[model samples]
Target: MHTDLWNYALALYARPGVEAACLQLQEDGADVCLLLCASWLQARRARVSDERVCALLALAEPWRIEVVQPLRTLRQQWRMAAQGDAALALLREQLKGLELQAERTLLERLQACSQQWPAGSDETADDWLVRLAPDLCRDHGALDQLRAAASALQDAEDGD
Candidate 1:
């Protein structure tokens, strides 16, 4: 498995169906960054705990509220306008970049905070995914697809 959260995320997200699954999960109000982190932890075999979940949530919520959401909101709001106006489109593209950067920063923070967590626990990645997933998406199929994709990514790595 990849050692860094960002690369792991990029790899996992690049997998077939993973991006769509993440988009679906995002639509259901789950944090994609958190979901990616959960997948990373699961790949790493980190044991999930209430305290760890709480810690990750506490670290992520504010950043999402203060940074990521605003960029995302603005970019989404400009979707129509950006299509008609080249200037607006450029600005929207920049906003998209900013939103991506914000997400990247959040991933970095999550990785930094969770990197020290030791592995070798009985907790499966499903435990991490389920624990961190929003209640709204607890039973969603996209979450299952994400899990399956993660497993496939891990399996591919294991083969290598």
Candidate 2:
């Protein structure tokens, strides 16, 4: 497993079903960056607590709202326009890269904030997922899928 949060995120996001699952969670008001951070923490075997989860969200929420989402919205909005206009397609691609960088930055900051946290925990990956997105649990199917994906990521990391 990659120790750097950005690399870890890229690898995890590429896994089958993860991108779609993350988008579903995001549409349900979950912060995908924080979720990725939670996954990273789980991969590292970090102790998770409500307080720690709250603190990480506090650090990530504003930037995600102000910087990342706007870029994402604009990039998505341009999808139709970009399909026909070559120049527009080029510019949209650039915005997509910027949006990705913004997310990468958020992940880096999350990693920095949690660097001092101690590892060694018996908590399952679902424990962190539940703590991070409690509301999602209301949808059992979605929550179960997310938990499975997260657990798979942790299992893969453990094997590395």
Candidate 3:
């Protein structure tokens, strides 16, 4: 299975626009390690090889350690700094635009993935959306936008 999926990844990687999307996603901080692993899987087609996946996960260790973990720490710090509801409210408004930027980056990544992968039926790549849905919706109505985008894609595909 891993072998097949690796071939699929190669096919996907070779797809005309995929490399550009991949590069942009990397620039957007979409977890290069995970992207590499997914790319491997997409090329190979079969289930990803455990050994390869493990090695790649190990490589991503630093990203988790240096990037995401620190961000979590900072979020905690921000919460603590709020002092009270009014302060929290002020911080929330101040951070809204930054949050929107992050969401846009993520949604762009997801749309790129959908464009590369087949979106027919239940096989659409739902896992990515599942992981991000909560954070994208946490502070805004972006979930509705996401849902609408997804719905439009589904409808368009169904029409085809």
Candidate 4:
């Protein structure tokens, strides 16, 4: 299990089905960075309170909206345009890297904000997931899949 948030995120994200699960969660308005942070916290057995969850979201929302999403939108918008022009494809790839870096920055910020919280005995990954995305009822299936994937990864790491 990696102690650093960024490494933990990369390893967890590389798990089977996790990428698609994360994309599905993102489509439902969940912040993937926050979700990854929550997974990290859960793996560490950290305390997950409503207040802390809210605080993490508050810290991450602005960055996600202003930086990550715009780059993502541009990359998506350029998908077709990049198909014909080699230069456009190169530029879109660059934007994609920027978007990834922005997401990494968000994860770092989130980890820094919550690093002081003590581990709790009562909360599960599902608890963090629900608090992190309260409106996830719109797609219960996707939410459940994410919860399962995160929990599985955390459990795997903890068992190591």
Please, what is the TM-score per model?
0.96, 0.87, 0.30, 0.89
Give per-residue lDDT, candidate 3, residue 134. Answer: 28
Each model's total of backbone clashes? 0, 0, 23, 0
Write down the lDDT of every candidate, Cα atoms only: 0.93, 0.81, 0.42, 0.82
How large is the C-alpha RMSD of every model relative to the true structure?
Answer: 1.3, 2.3, 13.0, 2.1
Give the alpha carbon lDDT tens digit for every residue of 1-160 in model 4.
7878999889878888888878987887888888888777876778667688789988999999999999999999999999999999999999999999999999889888987887655655446666676486335676667667777877786684
Candidate 1's TM-score reads: 0.96
- Candidate 4 versus the native: TM-score? 0.89
Candidates 1 and 4 compared by TM-score, better number: 1
Model 2 regions lying over 4 Å from their true place: 123-126, 137-140
lDDT of 3 by residue, 1-160 (tens): 2223333334444544555654454444445335534433332232333454455455445545665445445555677566667877576556654543443343344334334433223433423322322242323333233333334433443474
Ranking by TM-score: 1, 4, 2, 3
> Which number leads on lDDT?
1
In model 1, where do residues sit more than 4 Å from their true spots?
Answer: none
User: Which parts of model 3 have CA positions greater than 4 angstroms off?
Assistant: 1-46, 83-160
Q: Which parts of model 4 have CA positions greater than 4 angstroms off? A: 120-126, 137-139
Worst 10 residues of 3 by lDDT: 129-138
Report the C-alpha displacement of residue 24, candidate 3, in angstroms: 28
